[model samples]
Target: MKRKINCETARNFSIVKALEKLGHFPKKSNEKEAWFLSPFRSETQASFKVSKTKNRWYDHGEGIGGNVIDLVCKVLTCSIKEALSFLNGDTLFFSFQQQQNLLKKETGIDIIKVQEIEHPALIQYLNSRGISVSIANTYCKEVWYLYKASEFFTIGLKNDKGGWELRNKIFKNSSSPKSYTYIQNNNKQLIILEGMFDLLSFAIMEDVLLNTSDILVLNSISFIKDIEKFIHKYIIVHLYLDNDSAGKKATQYLMNKYEHVIDKSSSYRNYKDLNDVLSYENRKEI
Candidate 1:
């Protein structure tokens, strides 16, 4: 029989619990109200509020609000059915347990049992991506996998999914379609990039230049909407979007709508992205 979905079942999957799952916590809580750091933007202040009685959330910074499901949908960027399936712990859809078990049996290795990384190959993979070994170590971990009864290792980025976005040595692959690194300073300025490699390349090039600017990598251009509110909040936004036609279109679209956002594409007009520029001789030295 097809089970029914209801608001009661949905509300049981609390917005508070979902935010907590995403490493966000309420700054203050009482019987009625819960205050939290804005999950939509990088902010030290607690601007996101939840009414426990109503099971509703409001982001004062972004001026967005709704029920618990709305919060989950926004955070995961998934549809109502997807969010419901996730909340229900549906084994067929987005089950982390199933994925972990599958990863374990296929690799003949337990992912959780894998010890601390001391792998040089993983380090080299980060280096190839223009990410320094130290920076990679700060944000990611080396993971050993058993796939098809073969043992292999990959560099994995910790994601909201609680799954590692694995980048294998042979293919340079990522498990998630979204592969962007995010960094926020004091939240006054914002810098946006397209991909992980481009973000790393930009970091290498503008390490000293980016002091207080928050960095966001879109992973995919589709995630751009996720950060739109943040873009509106900040005073200055430096868009280092890719040099490709799609990138140009996105940049132009954003520039037309946003007054504070600046297109920094003139500098990389000849290259496809930051990594392409960084790959050349004498480019790495800069």
Candidate 2:
């Protein structure tokens, strides 16, 4: 037998649990209220709020208030019936639970040390990639980490979830949670990157990025679906993806779906990605 839930049942469901399926969680919470970064737009502050006692939500940024069903309709862009179907569906329930399990404690990662990015080997590695040491230092940390029972030092880029994306001349991995690294701004413009290296490359190549526009480093292409909700709010979105097949398909899908989406891959038309372009340009100067 199948359990069919009505809109009445959904109206009383928990918005916090509903949002968990959409990857929206409270930045701060208590017994009364839970505050979150607005799923409707990109902003530094947490403007969307949920009332634990009442099981209702209010997005102060967007001036919207509703129950769980309405919240689902707004966030997922689905109609009432569609939203109801999703609320009653098993797929989202399992995904929400799986995400919770994956993010549980974010254990297995041990930080042996953290220091300034000034080591000669690390500095030399940055220079070889044409990255400015000072710029890299602002976004990256020197980390001595343990993985697979072995210890190694690497350049670490912190994700929005407080997990570090660890990279070096050889080792490339991330602490648990594996979330996106969001550089937030109030600007209507948005730039998306596949990795932190590309973000560092953008900072070096473009002089206007002194926190002027919002940027998101997905860290992995698998994050595309997770970040898609935040992308539509941008008036203009520049996709700085690689020249490879996967990047091409992603860029194409995004461009076709959103009129504001633009492929900026042509800037690095001859290279694999923006980092490669930066390296090639730097080599030309040598």
Candidate 3:
């Protein structure tokens, strides 16, 4: 029998989880609350807040605040029933476990173990994204994590701060101490990218090794400001960000702020991002 979902049950869902599902990951988070860039509008600073204790969200930019249901309605621009249905769809595995021990261990998700990328499912996921197994094993790791009290695995890319950008077919998340991944080659040229997949896609398309250039994966666009201090050091900065409004805005900002900054997004203008172009090309050959 199908379980019935009402406003009461729907409101119990985690607002932070929903925002992450919508691609609005946290800029910073603690036990009590998490901050994210407003999903309603693009801004440099994160003004959206999700209170983990209250299970509610407040968008300072919009001057509005509400519960999970209200957040879903606003984000999807849908009716109450539709919002309930949406919440119900993922309710079974909907975990908002605030266990004190888990929180102390890691902010949101818990890392069980990390090994070389060898899982068949993970391999398939990499192939689907046009990343070869050899390249994946060379760069990424098979990270098995505990979420909702269940073990799941994904291709994990480590950042400078020792956090992991966890991604698979269905789930996309990051561990605590969220920071950018900088692969320094001690070279004068630097290439900037958005996600781990973008870095892998660039490697595949350009056929270059990690030491070819100093690479910086922002992991999230919100971290762009954090990289400002050292970004100017590179003689040439190539940005292969997504072909979206935020990406364009960031590219323009960098170009205006520094010399030798180049927008490499034009190469994949027709696609959403570098990974999208690679995925499309891979599909063509199949």
Candidate 4:
């Protein structure tokens, strides 16, 4: 019989331990809260706070708060079942029934195979995505046979699970599937984009303008709720959302809520998005 999953076991999974593994040692701790750098965004201040006593979290910067499981779910971007399985150590190995037929399917061997950096297939995949091998090398790495019997690959980032965050890769056409990307600079100024392409396009434009401002890709417009608090914390925020109806709605909603925040992209009313205008004007300089 299949074993039943346990929630208590999953809840016992330590948020503190996981954050430590992510290289975020809590800077402040009392009986109730533990403060640390925002794990979702690059920031100098400690805005991501965990409530040790209540086993909850509140990211003052992003304004997202929930229980430990919520943090795990957001960080790993996995479903509840997957998160529980991960905590139960089921992710690392297969069951006995699988072991019986493992050799016939080569499942055991594939599971143990180590991913190489210069794999031909991986290199080709990256190139096909309109991303350079060097860029992929800098931001990501290939994983071998991580999933089941298949040779799965993923991009490496600071976050533990190396799955593709779907942020700025040209190969990832739409942000529908949901991915995460973070952009920041020394300056207090910050900008958030709705998609990976938008972020890349913004980065290119920022480079041309010699602007040192920070940028972030929400990967999905829905993540707007996730980072609403972070937006308020910043002294100056430029909303460069897409000019589509949904984007317009989101922009208007935020503007009405936060009058002080600037909507920079409102100036580009003619273009559907920053990328469209950049591409339209023959602005290859970006």
TM-score of each: 0.53, 0.61, 0.68, 0.44
2 or 4: which has the higher TM-score?
A: 2
Using TM-score, rank the candidates from best to worst. 3, 2, 1, 4
* Best-performing candidate as measured by lDDT: 3
Which 10 consecutive residues of model 3 have the lowest summed lDDT? 96-105
Ranked by lDDT from best down, the candidates are 3, 2, 1, 4
Candidate 1 lDDT, 1-286, residue by residue in tens: 7665565678766778767654466778998989986554333357789988888898865567998788767765457887676566563543222322222111233354344445776665565556676655655677776555545666666544344545433323333333345676777888988665666576678876565678786655556666786787788898987775557888898899899999998888887677667666344575
The number of clashing residue pairs in model 2 is 0
lDDT of 2: 0.75
Of candidate 1, the 10-residue stretch with the lowest lDDT total is: 97-106
- The digit string of per-residue lDDT tens for model 3 on 161-274 reads 998877765445567777889888798989999988988988888866446788999988877888987787888889898777677888999999988989989899999899
Alpha carbon lDDT of residue 92, candidate 3? Answer: 30
Off by over 4 Å in 4: 1-148, 152-163, 167-180, 208-211, 266-271, 277-286
- lDDT (C-alpha, whole model) for all candidates: 0.64, 0.75, 0.77, 0.54
Q: How accurate is candidate 4 locally (lDDT)?
A: 0.54
Error of 3 at 33 (Å): 16
